[model samples]
Target: MMSSPSPTTAQASSTAVAKRIARTARLALEKKFAVVTAQIDRELESAEDVVIDCFYNADSRTSQLNKDDEYVHLLKLRSRQPFSLVKSIVLKDGEYEGHVALIMKQAFPFAFMKLNMEIRKHVYEYLFESEEKVIRIKTKTGGQKLPYAPGYNTYNRAAILAVSSEVRLEALPVMYDRKFCFESTSILMHFLLQICDGRIYLTDLNVESYVGSTARTSFYLLANCKRLRRIFFKHISSNEQPKTAIKNFWNDAQPWLTAASAGQGDPTAALKLLVFDRTAFHFRVKDPNSKSTSVKAWQLADHLVFVKGLKDKLMDARKV
Candidate 1:
């Protein structure tokens, strides 16, 4: 720690700003889960009025830009990188999908680059700090000392990158298979365990509840073994998912949100800080559901949050 506050603190906000970057991830993941669960229950009840076939065309639909808004702006043509620009696998549930998009870099097209090393993907997020070792300098206004520091401070930066090109699951060999969710969930658990060691918040764009499901569940998966941090989400989807899906998402995710949306002057930071002070904060995003993640994350800041849902056929691989 330093004795005096840094001078440049006034020039910048001096706080660790969560870098927002542009990205497109698996859409309505929680909703997908909810829908499938509902669909399954309905199936059990023999409810057959819903037409469940138009969602995923088993045969490759023409791959092109669908000109959709952010949340539903999934499925696009990649200008670069041969492997999946789309993060994870989109499983076709009987009704909708139990798809998975990777926030961690799934894998690089190493064969093209020929690095001869396995591509390790991770959602490495650091907010405003350019570097890891950020020291805060609290500012004082009234009668006396600040909280042992000044309101101004400075730090370097963290890894920030937006999805430069379009990412599409259709681009990758991923198919919408319904039988693989539980197994897939297990694999996701394994991957989360391997990379995530502590209570680190994994941010995401909430296409649904914005802050909760996208951010909380991602963090919870990582927090399974450890305590979790602030997992903030910015909403990026339209309101088309089943109402039950939305409710279940909120029901499961609100605790994290209520806790995460705690103190601090900046609503965003306060929302994010809610995670830091408590066990974990499940943040739904603030953006509209129609905004694309790439638009939201990239256009907003220098870095964006991505959770890597490992692309491996998780059933085959053992957790490290």
Candidate 2:
């Protein structure tokens, strides 16, 4: 029989095998990433705004984007790339709320161009820099400090994008099927509220949901916004029921009227224009006693004229 190989030789062989496996895995991931990027580029060729939905299921081998006008194209990342990306970020419960959202300042089409190989290498290092480093820089320069805004310091993905100049991508760990009592609109709210700078022109406020006291929240949001020139509510389908909470909240004191009454220091005073789309105040109601509470195709829409009345009141108040 041939002499047994030395223990050192066997260890070397095992190390070689591990290296090969790692190389193979990285190459596979790179290929998958490249394919996804190519489809995104194709979408950018025609669509003005291309959104890349990196949301992927672990069990699924493909990531797809809806072909509708809402989304430009689909990215099928059915490989280790998605898993690897997930690993890069830490997941904490109740860290942020509502939905798993990424504060994407630049669309994926544009971000891809910005995050080249060389740039990516430095992006994470800058992002993960310590507070000590930040303090040192500030102390050395004694530069003007950033603005102090309460409920605005939480560093969500959007905040990271706002402050950083790195070629890095940030993702928030999302609770897909998990349910929570208080939905977290903190990230999106901060993003919307921070745009109050004089140079930023907010022409539209698209309300996506009305389930979670969104009306009241919106009331406060508009109360603080000074530069909003026009406002529009998202189209509400006839099948959707109007939230009683919203009606009850506004019943106490109409928001627009109250804002109009304020003498000064009221942000809503900047509002000179209001656009009411088809779904601005349209609501649906189904008889609860009916055996079938399902919404009927012929359900007539009832207009919530309360807002219209408030508008008239505001106009008269302004005239006086």
**TM-scores for the candidates:** 0.18, 0.31
Return the top candidate by TM-score: 2
Residue range 132-221, candidate 1, lDDT tens digits: 232222323567422321221343222122222222211111111100111122233333444332223233211212333334454355
Over 4 Å off in model 1, which ranges? 1-190, 201-219, 222-246, 262-320
- What local lDDT does model 1 show for residue 2? 65
Q: How accurate is candidate 1 locally (lDDT)?
A: 0.30
* Tens-digit lDDT track of model 2 for 1-320: 79988999999999999999999999999999777666543221223343333433233434344556353334443222223232233335574534343333332223644566667544544444343322111111236322232332235323444434332233111101111111122322444344444113333344333433344554565554444455443333334334442345354325643663467554334334444345434344557788455443322233444344444545565566
